[model samples]
Target: MLAGIGLLAAVTVGLTGCAGSGGSAPAASGGISEAKAKTATSAADFGGMKGLVASANAEGHLNVITLPPTWANYAKIIAGFKKKYPKIAITSANPNGSSADEVAAAKSLKGQSTAPDVFDIGTAVLNQNLGLFAPYKVSNWADIPADFKDPAGKWYYDYTGLMSIGYDSSKVSTPPTSFADLLGPSYKGKVAIKGDPTQANEAASAVYLAALQSGGSADNIQPGIDFFSKLKKAGNFLSVLPTQATVNSGQTPVVLQWSYNNLAFGAAGGSAGNPNWKTVILPGSALGSYYNQAINVDAPHPAAARLWQEYIYTPEVQNLYLAAGAYPATLAAMQKNKTVNEATLKTVGEPPANFVQLTADQATKAGTLLSAKWRAAIAG
Candidate 1:
């Protein structure tokens, strides 16, 4: 849901603070020689990023999917990559697509020049498509949390956030403080969601938060589905893609989405004259999760892919993650290295002391349930 609308919907530019999809098989080792065609898990294994960078420069291109410039400040990330590696050109597709779409591209575009070299995926989708990914460990591997990465180093979390309510404080006299408050009369015809929960990971997380607040747990999300049903029946729910434009125009004044997205949307449109846009991760719904990053098994530009991974996990890139309001995976390492700026951390906020993190299995179950019941809930 961290989107810069239309930056690259058909072709454009684009967390982990939550759970995701995955498996463990350590990066090929134990006498696994570094063949020229082999995927490099680390720059050191590939003779270093300098060599990888040289090879990638020869290839001169990288294809990425589902990245928008505005999402996590990817505009800056992509621009940085291009400037840093002037020879390697980057083109993205399906900017508004989902984690499922990233997996889909890895499968659908195999052997094509346009195939994605890397992926940013959700926990469930990551687990479901582990076979499609190649194991990779960046130079900053030690900086990442053990729990946030694959035991074998196939994939790892980049950043994360919690589900929260974004509202134009000026439009709604009193904003909702919790899930139950969303159902009150003050919010009718005002609340909107990102997309159908069953299909989109962000939407699905919002639904999970609702379920948790409505007497459900990771294993059972029926309460969330039921809550939305009541929301629809009460005429408070609108199935709109909550973008910055929608918020600016006051068409969808209240949105349920990730805190980073909400905060970004509010910041984009809020001014001194109209400074009431706010984000609230209620006491009842502080779910923390993160998205994962991995290389495609059959990436068109393998060397470039490995180099990209190395660059992203670097300290400078990790700070960019914070600049865009994401808690980077290297947070602790950055702090320890005296590279982390405490003031910058404030912008992204701290991970909740009371947070609900879904496991890969729990996410799959919730996704299935949401798929089966979401459309009927809103009759959408």
Candidate 2:
């Protein structure tokens, strides 16, 4: 999850490290020119879905970055796409990398056959690297809210989850109810943030949520930094980047992460090693954020990349995200049309109305502040 607009704002907004010049072939010697796919703004540009599918089938591959199988049910989503289009093979790299890593990978692999075709990134990173994305709208563009996508189609939100506190019940008799509860001695050396705030959107959102809880707003994140400083000083803030294995092993017993991720871990339960893992969204501390999806400007498999955008935006795929506990970008439309999965709706429910989200500007500013202050404030 990355910095995005709040629900009120229509609830808007990878790791690759390296730099490379993205280049394109002069023309396709065969069918469905790569140059044409690179410049296409919609399926209509390719003569419609049949033409687009044929072009993509000719390309035969899609390279993606920073998509972990376990996160937000990507495994099943990927499988579903494969089932739908067996001709297009999907290759995902650096599944655990941050948004920054995605940018780096784009640069490093530019013009190569293995270069990523699309990106799933945070709004903060998206704003900072706007030049890298190509402008292309999906078939269901109208279904997405105005605030959730760029008018030019450079990027659009894919799915979202609320910020939450996840803890191991057996390890801590008193589960944390709020950010203040984390400062007590019982939680010393137990709490962990997902990743480095300066580089990872999840960690940045965790800070953003803490800011709200500690007398700060979207534009003011210093309080959140100060709150973490206080936690560090009290020996309760652990600097480790947490993962599923860490949570299951009790290494990072208390973690600040997205609700969907925590819920997934809890669902894994004893079978995955941690029997008492639980997730909670603190009252009055609701914070929601969505990750944006974009096509790489110099994607190696241009047609395949565009096809991927078309495939994922379908209501069926959106419903897949819901089953994984993530609220899809087309959620409102799904609900209005009664296309959403009722069972999933009953389980996860809708996003909180009061949750606050940051606009692109707010996220960029907050990210800058974190880059400058986060490390020094929480340094051990």
Candidate 3:
């Protein structure tokens, strides 16, 4: 769910299985042996990036699902990939689908030419479906932190954002400074999360954040559920999913989402977007989470799938994420090597010093609890 940012409109996009082999049977392309390219862990396996690109071009198609154009500057990234490798045809599907939808698509489309070549997903969902991923390290694998990726490269962190409150300034005359403030009558019937917490990472994280603010620790998310139940009871929570159109129209006046998403909304807003949109980080509430990228083990276009992975990890694409207010997974490496855009970094600013990124176990535990309790807790 990573909310795919603001899906503006549906665009289609949509992982799996081993350190070297799962069930992918890539055909020989550009003279590369079928087995060699199919099992390539790194570009060096194909001799280098040049060889990988050639093989991918020969295969000539990438089926990505659930990647919304408005999310994390993906439109430009997709366009850039096309410009860089024109021979590779890209098919993007189900742009606004949730993380669960991504998994479902991969299952239903298994063994087909149109199955998702890659996935951009939440950690919670990815962990639950690990068998679906293929382990393949990118060229810059060493640069990624051990904590952000699986040891076998089944999946790796892509970009991330901290939880924050976004509000239409015109509608919220007195800005809320904390989760507690959101319950005030001034904000009644105005607050919303990104999607169903039981099915979406962003919404789930919002609940986690509420848990932290309402006396629960990372190990216990019950307070978050209790808090939402209270919000609903107070008539301060809106059930509708907020979008660009909703924000601009003043239908969804307040939202709980990632900093990057809200910041993007406000930046593109003020006139053509929201007339007075603003994003705020509530005091002592910096819950951060990163979306992950994984190649489907049963990918129809194996070579192209790996190629796309290599492309996104490049400095150009990483900076594109930063420009859109997201913190790329390679940010630490980029900073050390002085490759990051200084201006963009300054514009994006630093995340709260106390930002809390849940461990894999923590996310799993939370998702399980939500799956069981979220519906009943939020039901009217």
Residue-level lDDT of model 3, residues 40-67, one tens digit each, is: 7888888898989888877778888877
**Once superposed on the true structure, which residue ranges of model 1 sit more than 4 Å away at CA?**
1-38, 268-276
Cα lDDT listed for each candidate: 0.73, 0.81, 0.81
Model 2 C-alpha lDDT per residue in residues 31-127, reported as the tens digit of each score: 4688888999999988888888888877777787888766776777777777798877778788889999999999998878878889999889889
TM-score of each: 0.86, 0.91, 0.90
Q: Which ten residues in a row have the lowest lDDT in candidate 3?
A: 11-20
Ranking of all predicted structures according to TM-score, beginning with the best and ending with the worst = 2, 3, 1
The 10-residue segment with the lowest total lDDT in model 1: 16-25
- lDDT for model 2 comes to 0.81
Cα error, candidate 1, residue 198 (Å): 1.8
Identify the runs in model 3 with alpha carbons over 4 angstroms from their true place.
1-28, 31-35, 269-272
